[model samples]
Target: MVVREDSVETKHEAIELVLARLLRLGSLVAAALLAVGLTAMVVGLTGIAPRLITAGLLVLLGTPVLRVAAAALIFVRERDWYFAFFCAVVLAALATGILLGRAGG
Candidate 1:
């Protein structure tokens, strides 16, 4: 079986497009949640506003991590060891930072 260069490039482009869309969707959702939360707060619905804001912030923070995980999965599926390894390292670092931040706090 032979894989052509153009096909590989196409696959790469498709993967990038998927990732880009994921990021854009995440950002939009987070922004919407934040906006609603703030509006709720201004309208005096304080009880649920904070929770909504926190959720939005969490989603914003997790977006990049999710993107990395998705990329890692895609790379692993495509048998791209180098990119997969780098993604793993980045994930580890992100995890470590979160852990350290929590511990310090």
Candidate 2:
């Protein structure tokens, strides 16, 4: 019974390790997409290149955001309210920056 309940600190660490592994895999896939996109662009495949590039960029950009989110969830589950609050703030800031940058560009 007692053994069935996992502690928060250890859970946080385990989640982080999994996220790290996922991030690496995501990076590899993103790179492949980028390469294919660029190759298609060079070969004048009009419809596919930009889409592939966009997909790659989305994956790259989203990975960190996902990391923050996962951390936030873990923090919440652990009842680490302060860290969870800060994570929310960081996410808001990041979203605002992305929105502003897109609008400005």
Best by TM-score: 1
Write one digit per residue (lDDT tens) for candidate 1, span 1-105: 256646766666667887999899999999999999999999999999999999999999899999999999988877779999999999999999999999999
For model 1, the stretches where C-alpha displacement exceeds 4 angstroms are 1-3, 11-13
**Candidate 1 positional error at 17, Å:** 0.5
lDDT of 2 at 22: 74
lDDT of candidate model 1 versus the reference: 0.91
How many clashes in each structure? 0, 0
By TM-score, how accurate is candidate 2?
Answer: 0.71
- Per-residue accuracy of model 2 over 1-105 as CA lDDT, tens digit each: 444346554445666687788799889989999999999999999899999999999999888898899889877876779999999999999999989999999
Model 1 residue 15 lDDT score: 74
**Candidate 2 ranges with C-alpha deviation above 4 Å:** 1-6, 9-13, 42-44, 100-105
Error of 2 at 15 (Å): 3.7
Pairs clashing in candidate 2?
Answer: none
